[model samples]
Target: MAKTLNPSFSALYSYRIGSYYFHSNNRLFKFLGSRMRMKLIFKMNCDISFLAKIGDRLRLPHPLGVVIGAGVEIGNNVIIFQNVTLGSDGKKGKEKSYPKVGDNVIIYADSIILGNVKIGDNSVVGAKTFVTIDVPPNSLVIGNPCKIIIKN
Candidate 1:
């Protein structure tokens, strides 16, 4: 009783001749699917690096011009707009710090979320706002210092 290989895996692993073309085709299809899914997911996770960790529930209106730094932790149902930067504050020895965002967070266009700050759940950061500090849950923040504009 010998174990049999799966057809797709066997086809992918067996021959080197047709396998190249076959795998290429498969990879092309996979890439296309990932791209389309990325677009859709971006509508929901704007930052690719962030999506890499959180698994694409975060939507980005436009992924372009978005830079999500390493060590950033994003929660579920997050929506980010275009031209957003989520990164470290680059303060004295703060280059390694990353922002931790909570669930249902909505960050608008051109907003910068930086430092070792934690944005609470259901919070919204308005466009062009710069946040360098922590935000409470269910708060709407705007402006340079990111004062809480409203609480939900």
Candidate 2:
């Protein structure tokens, strides 16, 4: 079977357009002329930062303060709340791993998901929860050492 193309490629394309516009202009005033354009630039920066793994269905309530690490494979329909970090654990390079987030997952606010963990599809992670293990599909995890409170 042929490999599927990324759906967010169009968004990345538009981001590149903004990047080109920002770099092409010589005058500073003309560049930052309008407030809408400035906001567009900021959004473009966030989009381009994690251009590799961000899926088409990825929705950010507040794009700012959201950091997505490189090589992280995010599935479609994933909603990430603000102040969320999805990246490596930085364990002295003991093992190189990236979080593989499954489709239709909802990650709540201020949650820290570390290590090379696998979060299954349709799972909901509560706010302020710290997940370090593989969560089964359709499960709900909450608290410091995230546990399976509900199984679907």
Best by lDDT: 2
lDDT of 1 by residue, 1-152 (tens): 12223322222122222323333558775455455445433543333442224423666545556677757888888887778888877778444788999999999999998888899999999999999989999899999867886584
On TM-score, the candidate that comes out on top is 2
Model 2 misplacement above 4 A = 1-48
lDDT measured at residue 22 in model 2 versus the true structure, 0 to 100: 51
Q: After superposition, how far is residue 62 of candidate 2 from its true place, in Å?
A: 1.7
- Global lDDT of each candidate: 0.67, 0.69
- RMSD of each predicted structure: 12.2, 8.8
1-152 in candidate 2: lDDT tens per residue?
A: 22223323333444444445555555653353332244434653343332336565677655445566766888999988767788788888487567889999999988888878999999999999998999899999999978787673
Clashing pairs in 1: 42-60, 44-58, 44-59, 44-60, 45-58, 45-59, 45-60
Candidate 1: list runs displaced more than 4 Å.
1-47, 50-52, 92-95
Question: Which pairs clash (backbone N, Cα, C closer than 3 Å) in model 2?
Answer: none
Each candidate: how many clashes?
7, 0
Cα lDDT of candidate 1 equals 0.67
